[model samples]
Target chain A: MSKGPFKLERAGLLQLLQALKTQGYLTLGPTVREGAIVYDELHRLEDLPIGYTDHQEGGSYRLEQRGDGAMFGYNVGPHSWKRFMHPPILRLFRARQANGDLEFESEGEAAPKYAFIGVRACELQAIRVQDRVFLGGPYQDPHYKARREQVFIVAVNCTQAGHTCFCASVESGPRAQTGFDLALTEVVDGEHSYFVGEVGSEAGARLLDRVAHRAAQEAEWNQALALVDRAARQMRHLDTQGLKERLYQSLEHPRWQVVANRCLSCGNCTQVCPTCFCTSVEDHTDLAGQVAERTRRWDSCFTADFSYLHGGSVRVSTLARYRQWLTHKLASWQDQFGLLGCVGCGRCITWCPVGIDLTEEVAAMNDVQTGRFAPKEAGGAHV
Target chain B: MVSLPSPIVVDPMRPRPFRVARVMRETADVVTLELEAQTGPPLRFQPGQFTMLYVFGVGEVPISISGDPQKPERLVHTIRKVGAVTEALCNLRKGAVVGVRGPFGSHWPLEQARGHDVVMVAGGIGLPPLRPAIYHLLHHRQDYGRVYLLYGARTPRDLLFPEELKRWQYTLSHAPGATPVRVTVDRAEGDWDGAVGLVTSLIAPLTIDPSRTTALMVGPEVMMRFTIAELRKRGIPEENLYLSMERNMKCAVGFCGHCQLGPHFVCRDGPVLAFPQVRDWMTRKEV
Candidate 1:
């Protein structure tokens, strides 16, 4: 009667799609294909990642299958809530010259009510970061502010760890504390599997009432808690306290040189980064060549031209630019936005050509911060 | 006779290829264009902001406000033909059309500098940005403190606003709210009786109450740097000093980081920056 938690049998849960579809719900979840885990238009429950999990680091990425058909078994991905909310590129305004007057037209808003099927804790935090970035900021981005309000989130507890994940280190993860419409913990037994789904919103409670599910018993809740606890214990973690300040002080640290030697400057890390939102503007005239239209494109900090000015670029060297980017994401981000830029996702390390792990980088910096490593003379150190 | 006050509801101005309204070849490289904002609201800009002047295939460049802010009807851009867009803009004839986006970037602190004695120091073609300030000073002389101008051009002919400068000196002198003028040329030809040497050299002769004065400066960053250094030696506070900067600005909005200087966007946060606000970034090349 408390509406505390409910249980759905594993086989019955796979039919969760048919139930949602009949109820006019759009189920969006992860589908693995082409060696990468991507979000796509999913219709059937079969499209979900049942026995798949992924390994991600700075620049290295891999997707693999598990022994079981356990659904919802992956970490944060290249796509985040930003895509549905902000949309990578949106037309802001158009100028029309009419009757010798310029008119600034506000673009039409996107219309979609989304259901994020496999949301994780780190992503929940990432959503809040973007919320603060797009809405909480003084500008109040109209597009992001609107789309975020229409979504219903289904948070899944991570019972498996990814190589690049360290939300446990940053006090962000392993469990969904808040910011979800529904939270689920998948518990598998030898031949019998069930899910403990807790309704976090009235919208979720109303939706669940339509499905056939048993009220979770006290024992079932405890088992769900145990499953979540095990996942937390398995987390590959990182410590985030004062990490910003420590990184800021290490601008010339040899770690940058080591990272640059391996960095291809391919810009994969930022492309997959949930928090990187810088953009560039472009102007194009129609095929008729009568009118010109200006559009904005997503931009990355790794590009040297990104910082170019009248005289020259501020960051002239590759080493300095790389240091600026890494330090900004880990250190200066807090100074600019009052939050840690990293979400503990290991896409940077995993996708990196040379396996330049952020964990190792931070560990080296931590050691250097505490005087554990001998400072090298100029041009004397790299990795 | 008096003029009616200008409309301020301000429609979003549109860019039209004004058949080069009339190009006055000011100097070797600098030329001024008079364009009418087509079917768009009249263009309005402050002393220090800029407009993106676009030539068909040539590209766009940020040119400063070289017209009177009070006269928001017609748009005036004084450009130095240094790059592709500048060359294209210069090549346009009395009727060549082009696109324009702006009156963008933060304007000079005209209202803020109203009651304070204003010292204007400009170098090379940097004088365009200060053109609006000079116009404002001449228009509302009573509202401001004593006005002064220090101008320096690369050569005798490179100087701009020639006709206006002559009147601003002769016709506008002894008129209410007028400022003293000090013009200089780095290298002069015949009939150049103005002060010689750097623009900074002329500052020594002008007496300014640093405490009550605001220095409006525009020019090459180096010229502004040396002039500001000399002013600082005069014990001028950084708060009262200002500089209008330029970069290859593609988008005037804050979205594009092209015109960014450290934490601030030159288009939005400034084309005008107080010395103290940009002191750190100015140490690097971008600023």
Candidate 2:
């Protein structure tokens, strides 16, 4: 492998996939499935969403033809790499009763080594945020730690930004900075298509050596950087100046009630989000009551039962539930993990059925805070 | 290839089994169960820490340890039948087995409160969690100044450990370094002769040095809030006051995200927290 930035032609991309598979990694990448691009098992280059780019906005997503034959042309979709890392459902342990005595056994499935082919910069930061939640504490989550440690990241720098894309505003994306094994910038000029590859780890350099590649010229590297910069300029902005402090002070700011009026409480935003990581457990028993198993599944704060105690749910009204989710993501997460929960991926904005864009909501709150908009009468009853 | 750290072998979710040795009914809806481990050593826990008690076919709930900390051989828990899990736990008889994953969260800062007058305020079922701390103070009676226990319940019949309360109020009050006990009720009944009002009413008559007093309280959120206000008016600094909090907890190790009170996980960061640390949060509703 060359020392600096190297160039790989369209055919070399297939060779890179082959090299990763030969090294005993399960290659996962983007593919068109059910009219949406999602991450699935990839065995060949044709398995990618070639010549397809996504058009995204609040409450809408569509796949369109790029016509330029670019393989990695799309922004992020509804699925994230967390589906493979943390998993949506997991069996925690099992217990069996015999002779009035119970025996317990842990579900000890071995973690798999995965080569993630198309990780975005914001998604990478989301993975880091989850790492802090699961591994940074004194008691580590064994299930999360095992899979997270074995992941091989292959990050892709964005050349085209979707309408809802705001990673540039959060300082988390458009260009892959760190937390990746290998970073790629796809360069398509008229009839020529190639990837500008930069090795980030020893493993990435070893894989690059197996694929045929040449040192990139000065002009080619400059063109790659210019494309990412253009993508950065195309993104929408989210003003985060003192946002955490502002949200904490605005717990009863009435904007929550306004949003709750439109929100159906369907929880689609949490399902599509890359950084929301709350879970609840359920216990199951057999018909004879001999065997019992406990399973953990992803849980959303939108549900009233999420905060249920002995008597009843704490946040009974939709207004309180929405306030908890938003404040926890924007304000309280900083106090808990020392970092913002959102990476500005915009998946939540695009997938929300009512098109409740968080960036717009924050701007509205700022309008009231700065006295740009008149405050409504404080008569809205909250449970 | 990058080398990663090996996974920790101990799983925090697994619960050990314990057999019920004796069950004593404290009230019509509350019971105290003494448990002995089915296997392994006994559970050693500090005062104010809680355990995740699990019924075989039912579910699990967080219950604070109510026994003496020094007497770890017999694990004791006082439970009120509030939900399905607690109902099943209260019905448990001798020789019945249950699961327990335990001894989690912050404890009362008794060590830091040394040499200061200790005042404990408990309401309803909250006294069980504070009972262990009272036992600790009595065992090490020489380490503290004046000790007082102010307790209240819904009614006289609802009071727990009736015989023990009598001994502490009558016998111990005459002993050196005595722990004076004051009892109150929300409403009076037939043949009742005691103060009848909210527990905060009992705080006015206590002769305590606010500067040197350490107040520990446990009760419902509204009760704690009012008690905190009364304690503050008495000139007790916020840092010297402690309160035990309650929230819906699934994972006691802080992974479930169900027990979050603002940024703090009540299962891990507390069951007991300083008044100043949660002063701003307690004022907000449904946080």
Candidate 3:
């Protein structure tokens, strides 16, 4: 276990990633797909977002061309690493009646060892947040832990920031500072002509040792730092200080109602959010009526059926539902989970049908409360 | 860890081992069961709290505790043949075994209600949850001010605890320190002597000290709306007014989102709530 900060030639990056894929592990990385850079299954280095850089801002996203063709060129993606690890839907247990007796078997078999590639700093923070919920909560979610324990993390320092991105505001972005087995900063066409890689764990060091990497010099580290700073500068910033209090204090504030108007309540925001883990369980007997399985599927509070009661839905209006969803995400989550819900992934704003930006909503709420945008005469100190 | 008074609010073993001590047909569709704990100790649950009555092979349904919580060892439950689980529960024999989970949910604040006027209102089988509170008030007659009961039934025959009500009314009217009982029926016949109107009408002449007294209510949502409204007219704040709620509760544990009410887990946070605290979310459909 040598203390190592290794370097990899830009051209050899593809061969190293391709080799890792052949060993029965799903090599997941940022790839250009569905008009967005998203994390998904990758088999070869060709799937990497090579020669591509991303532009991100509130309520917008675009891809740009880069002069240097680097394998890790994009910032964070719409799809996160959780999709491969903590899948939205999972079968918790299967029950079958054999000889008139109930047999319940927990479904933890065949959990795969996924080599998650190109995880971003914000995305890494999201993973840790989920770890608190799945592993550090009252009951250990066996499914999540099983998949998480068998996985490998490869983080790529962001070189680009997407529109609708605000990881900078939440203080969890633009650089893979820690929480990854192997952290890489793309430095194509430079003197090193390679990735400035830092290993954070024994597994990361072992993997790096398998690849042909040279000792990174002081100039390599300086170049790597410049790239991270450039990405951070591109990020859309929000004043997140006192954000939790500001959001909760204004539950009845007009901004929530305003945001609700644009919200379609289609639940795409939660679906794409890396940290949202609310789920609904369904128990159904199979065709033979001899076996039954309880399957948990990703559920969003925005769903009308999510809060359905005997007589009707709790949040009958889309406005009420949206308010509840956002407030819970940014404000009350701190009260319940002891942490801010948003990890600044920007997926919610990007995936929103109307592109409702939370950073904008917070700013509006603050203005509305402080009389910043009032008619000047219609204002007194708000309670 | 001040010894979380009740460590397991929703015990894994629901519908605790209660053997049917007696079963009687209350109506063509409903039955009342006198249950005796088959194992260990009886449950000391609060009024308004419920249990997941489990019929081993069938399933589980949330049923209110109709029996005395004080004499928990010998429990009682009433069920209407509505859903599969309820039908299974109604079909149990006097000797059949059943599992129970709970005494879950917040109960009427009995200690807080002491030394204050107490008003209880019930509709249909909602009587079961209210019965415990009614019984508790009667047992401790001198603890509070006026103790009035306003009850409503869908029809004369749908009335539960008919014999018990008569005894309860007599106890209140004759017990040197008791309060009067007000009763009503939605549809009445056969020379019924009680008021024939919605239960809300009974609260018009009723005495309620909103700031000081506590009002406990249970019924269909519509009935509760009107009943609680009457209490408000009588100047009772939502906090002092409480109600018991029922929904499709799959797991008595807080893990399931089926019984969630906003930020609260109805299974854990409350089946009973301070009206003001829940009034906003209560009207919000599923909550």
Best by TM-score: 2
Which 10-residue window in model 1 chain B sums to the lowest lDDT?
Answer: B1-10
Model 2 chain A TM-score equals 0.94
> Which pairs clash inside model 2?
none
lDDT of each: 0.70, 0.86, 0.72
| TM-score for each model | 0.81, 0.95, 0.76
Isolated chain A TM-score, each model: 0.89, 0.94, 0.90
Task: Identify the candidate with maximal lDDT.
Answer: 2
DockQ of each: 0.13, 0.40, 0.14
Quality of candidate 2's docking, in CAPRI categories?
acceptable
DockQ of 1: 0.13
The model with the greater TM-score, 2 or 3, is 2
Q: Which lDDT tens digits does candidate 3 get at residues B1-287?
A: 00012222222422345667899898777898887765667777887788777654455667888877778877778888886668888887777666665667778899998888888888887887888887887788788777777888888888887788777776755345554677788888898877899888988786556688788888876677777777877888667888787654655554444565555667766788777656655554323
Model 3 TM-score is 0.76
Say what the interface RMSD of candidate 1 is: 11.9
- RMSD for all candidates, in order, please: 7.2, 3.2, 6.5
lDDT by residue for model 2 (A1-383), tens: 34698898978888889888888899999999999999999989889888899999899999999887788899999999988887899988887788878667878789888999989999989998888888777677888877787888889899989899999888898898988888999987654579997888877888888889998999989999999999999988898888887787677688888999999888888888888888898888999998888898988888888899878887778888888888788888998898888898999899998888999888778766643223221112122
Which 10-residue span in candidate 3 chain B carries the lowest summed lDDT? B1-10
Number of clashes recorded per candidate? 32, 0, 19
Sort the predicted structures by TM-score, highest score first. Answer: 2, 1, 3
